[model samples]
Target: MARKKSPTLTEAELRLMEVLWQRGEATVAEVVEALPKRLALAYSTVLTTMRILEQKGYVRHTEEGRAYVYHPLIDRNQARRSAVQYVVSRFFNNSPELLMLNILENEAIDADELERLKAMIKNAQEDGSEQL
Candidate 1:
């Protein structure tokens, strides 16, 4: 077999992983079913992408009776972090502020969520300071 390039998944892969994460375990059909139309992706394309995900250690699968039960090998938060790192490094040039500002601009965070998000950010900053 050709060396399956690098296993590192891109943003697209991470999105697919989200469906698998939510479902706990899923098959190719299940994942395809979960995708939104704007994804503009074909079933075979998703299958190939997920197989690459398996090769890259982002996902795992077991033979369940006659079906392949696929699930994420990594934690959802960790996968999110990895994808964030990639985007920050590649597009945002490692500036989290840009990403945060983008999210704040495009997404709606209600007051309760805003407060919770603020608390999380403050806690993370404080924790970082403690390590120094």
Candidate 2:
């Protein structure tokens, strides 16, 4: 059987998700207030976007008084991993090594940051060896 495709969030959806992920649960008003000032979104817009998110299974809402209190159904880390996987598959030919190489080549990494990365790679290699 074919696996169901994961939903990819738009920038707007991600903004709302960020609020939910931070707050754990929020009403439409709360979400709007928590949103970054630059977004300047209207209440109706936030409500509609949240409803769309609910439909997409990224969020779930419970009726609270006169408002719906929304919470993320997907954890932030889970969504981040899925987004990274999608990018790796689409833009890096499904190669995480290529993705890392691209980032290391393009980004400005100071000596300290390079050492941290090397340590992380070494730890990962050790963990992989232990698993084997």
Candidate 3:
């Protein structure tokens, strides 16, 4: 069966989601405090963005006293997989191999990281063979 498509998050929404993902749940003031200082967003901006995230189904909230405690509806790994799938389809013609090749060619992957990647590829190959 095909997987259901998840809603895409904007950069601002993702920032708010990060706070919820890390903290498990938080109030609007908490989210604002968790954000990077460079972002310089006001509490109102964070509250508005989180409300938008709720509308987009990326978050859910419970009322705590007078504040809404928000949490991520989607986990980080799920969001990462969806985002990667989007990039693969849109930019790499649905070819993950092409995407890896581009990254390997252009990015400054260190020796340790390269070895780790190779080990992962080897393990994947072994797993694939076992499944066949």
Candidate that scores best on TM-score:
2
TM-score of 3: 0.85
Among these predicted structures, which one has the highest lDDT?
A: 2
Per-residue error (Å), model 1, residue 110: 13
Which wins on TM-score, candidate 1 or candidate 2?
Answer: 2
Predictions in order: lDDT: 0.84, 0.92, 0.90
What lDDT tens digits, residue by residue, belong to model 1 across residues 38-76? Answer: 787887898888888888888888998887778888988
* Model 3 stretches with alpha carbons more than 4 Å out: 1-7
Worst 10-residue lDDT window for candidate 2 reads 2-11
Q: Over the full model, what C-alpha lDDT does candidate 1 score relative to the true structure?
A: 0.84
Summarize candidate 3's per-residue lDDT along 15-114 as a digit string, tens digits. 8898899999999999888889999999999989888888878899999899899988899999898889989998999999999999999999999999
Which residue runs does candidate 1 get wrong by more than 4 Å? 1-8, 38-40, 87-132
TM-score of every prediction relative to native:
0.60, 0.87, 0.85
The lDDT ranking, best first, is: 2, 3, 1
RMSD, one per candidate, in order = 5.0, 4.1, 5.1
